[model samples]
Target: MNYFLMLSNSHADGVLSWYQTLRLEGRMCDVVLEAEGVKFPAHRTLLACSSDYFWSMFQDYTLESGAHTISLPALSSKGLEQILDFIYTSWIALSPSTLEVTLQAACYLQVTPAVDLCIEYISESIALDNCCFFANIAAHYGLSKAFTVSNSFIARSMCRILVAEQYKAELLELNLDSLQEVLAAEEMPGVKEMALLQLALDWLEYNPQSALQSNALLCRIRYSLVPPDELSRLSAIEPALCTPFIHSVVHKALNYHLQGPLQPLLQSVHTSLRTTNSKILLVGGGPEADRPQNQILAYEPRTRKFRPLSTTLPTKLQHQGVCVVGHFLFVLGGEVVKVDEESEKSAVMTVTDQVWRYDPRFDQWEEMEPLLQKRAQFTCCVVEGVIFAIGGRGQRGEPALSSVEKYTMNAGCWRSGVSLPHPVHGQACATEGTGIYISGGIYGNSPDSSKDVLFLHAFEGDAWQRRASMSIARFGHQMATVRGRIYAFLGMYEPFCDIEYYNPEQDLWTHLKPLLNDRFCYGLMATGGRRVLVFGGRKWQEGQEVCTTNVLEYDTEYDAWREVCKLPGPLCGTQCAIMTIQDPPET
Candidate 1:
């Protein structure tokens, strides 16, 4: 093979690069542009060669109509100058500050190259921080490709994105229709009606003049997720709820969500949330040592490979709380340093208030505001955009803590939530429907005691309420939500892979098929909403504890467990989560 890179293109490059010089010299000039208040001279051939839109315009105004002035009124003189400069240079300086104006002019003139380049830049720039603003721009200019890219990013990172200072301004200025569409978009994870209601209330605070136009937006919220206390508190003051029709609809939905309705009036309301795409994430807990492994591995389901990421936690973080909000993984507080096996000094295992977030798009870990209190060995899950950190070991290696706190992704803040009925440590938590289910945790005792209890609760209003318990007693298990069902996979040293399912409607737990062998403390998660991926942890072999490097996959639809890939190295006391990495749309 021969490579002739950039060879003999010198002559062509010279002519194309000097288009501006010739135009300024008035060489073979055929037209003049009176755009806004400034005048620009150009040759018909030069303009035609640069853009099809320009060629079409020139064709209509024949050469016989020589020296004619084309009246360009849509853009300012500066906007037109940027376009002309790009035609000559094949480049433009695009920044967050200048992108919008240039895009407007390019779209107005139907410049395909300019428009496509701008769209590509926007797609590349889409992140949790700027997704909302870019989505609004994409929607306004009818850039469907950009819209899809930005909208999906916004939908996935809705809670985190909303808390951004930039998004606050963008949301207030957004057209009512666009704002409503954002609230109503499908495929949003960990977002409940209460969060949406909070968003709506925030919008009203910013744009109070639009209170009259909010009923249409309010109707889309799932009112049943809002607890009766909060609903009653806000109804007396919130304008949208004050409206008769909207208030009645909300009250009606609230009743249906709280009570058992024989037949429901609302058919379109989504009682269940949109299922998120999944990729397996293996978090903390590796080999025990003074120097520990902070490697966080993510399984690329599409590629069928396990890859270690640089976005590991700030600490060794064993027995930490991990959950997925959109594609971002939030790891709650855990033990910062390792504890000595023989010493058993409580000072060796220091707990931290740190909360970290791993963003797949950026491939980076960011430390958010710390928790209300330092904790370790806690159970956590995202319930409609809130990270609920349930019972765990308190500071100074104390017994299980019944106190719970949740981080609100919407506001970038953490506040106290209702505490669990009993203390819990090393429990498994998962979300289905409107509630978070706690299963098989050891509360204030060793792993053998009270480890098989289960409780279901949600943010009904302000307080925590308990539901029915599971039949089997399990502790030190992993939880994953698969197709709206909560599946519990338990054991590591005592090595048992028996799985169980919790039915919210029937309020019962059913045991599923057992695994190939006994496994314990493994990192278990549901990927692609159909397959359960069990990652590495230790298992007992002939009275010897050894790490299991092999991974297992459980196909829910087929009801089978098969041995899958093996980790490069085995890890124990590790945590795991599922994050769907979004690839940019094909051109």
Candidate 2:
């Protein structure tokens, strides 16, 4: 049997303590390590056992193998002394002022314990004040953990660092790779992509030789988030951004802005927002009382909570056609209700041709070119980069208008398109692929709603082609395209909870699971894939029509409906859109 002997931890510590005492007393020293005129007398065996640098140097057939003294000109005296103390005592004192020099000496001497201690101290002590300095040293020494921590710190503080004058020098001092890493992060609050673009351009202007890295730096910008007008202006003046590579990137972004209805599906690195928190924006609407409100609420789906946005509509609008082109919200052709000052319950509804575009980037609204005709209760759908406003009521008590107007973004004008098969209002519109489909609505001079469906493919300057009609006629209903199929939900003039989907390929209509309760005039949108979310709407209860706050989700795959939650309050005639908003910084 082999005999094994091992000393206890306390006994082992005692031996190291004895060696340290001997070194401190300047007795039995075998080598003198000198740096910057400062000398440390230590045992060769102890240094060789503690550091790989000393171990390899003191080995046989080496330059310093038989030497009694070694000079290290690359290290500082104070840093060398601190490292030597840790090798024997197993403790090191580190401060922000001395951390750089100390870390350099430990890394140069291959003292792993001291290096690890210095990194740990840096990781815990990182702050906005010294983060850039720490990042520079960490990158030079190839310290991955330290580099990552310090780099992330700079990115998270970018909003403050960019605006504060004190950090201008530090920001300009960042290396190319470090600056790219900071700009690539999306966690910066209160900082927009346009500002980031300017920062990159400013850096390029300051460091003219860095033009070679212009493409790499510019690619970090989410150009889709920038306004098209501003992007066009910048491209004209900034020569560096006009390079072939950057030009192609910018072209892709400009095209993405015109996608409209298809923007959600065409998301890319350039188009995707820099925010992780996306909220559903519920635009202007009214209650069952027919009084439209101007409040806009942002609903967070993850938390199932609602918060009002700081920006609201310029004026109260109802039955408006809402659509998002790029990051802008367009509210067009709605009835502006003016409540009577004396008669609290009475109000006058005036049809307006005014068009308002809301830019979330600046939280400001601009009056765009108004519609060609004043209308309300119309349905708007974007196809092939054009917004088509379909049939609606022109004047207050007039018959439904069959005229259609097309708004081309590039032209900034609304032109007449082919008329509908017949004048209809309260129709639900949806875009399937590149085709625009309008479902059941009230026809001209007809007391009852019709189930007739109309289709216009590619907007070929042709008349509406009649498609398969729904099983039941729907008016004031909602229609959405999910998983490439058109789904029509229950609406007014129809008390049934029946839900159905239209198959264009088959030219057929099939009934799916019916809703638990009948709803109409509700805010409906396709979250993604085969799922659809429905917000507040008016429902019939106890022989009376009332507004409901119930929020329901429909899953086409399961053919089922369930109440997910409730809106902040009962809202009808509202428009809901999914938007990416920056999350508030953590306290």
Off by over 4 Å in 1: 1-15, 51-53, 60-64, 127-132, 164-166, 187-192, 204-213, 242-245, 260-269, 273-550, 553-587
Tens digits of per-residue lDDT, candidate 1, 1-587, equal 99877767687668876777788787766788777879888877877777776777777566534546887887777777777777777787787777787788787777778888889989998776567778778888888898878766766666665556776556566556566766677666555457678788788778888877778778767665566677778887887687888789767766654432111222233443434445577787675322336887767766677767645566776667787774567888887776566774533567888888765533557778888888887888777667788888876547788888877654577888887777888677777766777776776756463435445456684554454565556667777778877777764334446677877777667889887677776777776469888777767678876778888889887879887777878776777776664332221
The residue-level lDDT of candidate 1 at 73 comes to 81
lDDT of each: 0.70, 0.84
Clashing pairs in 2: none
Q: Tens digits of per-residue lDDT for model 2 on 46-68?
A: 89988899999999989898888
Query: Per-candidate RMSD vs. true structure?
Result: 13.8, 5.7
Residues forming the 10-long window of minimal summed lDDT in candidate 2: 260-269
| TM-score, prediction 2 | 0.77
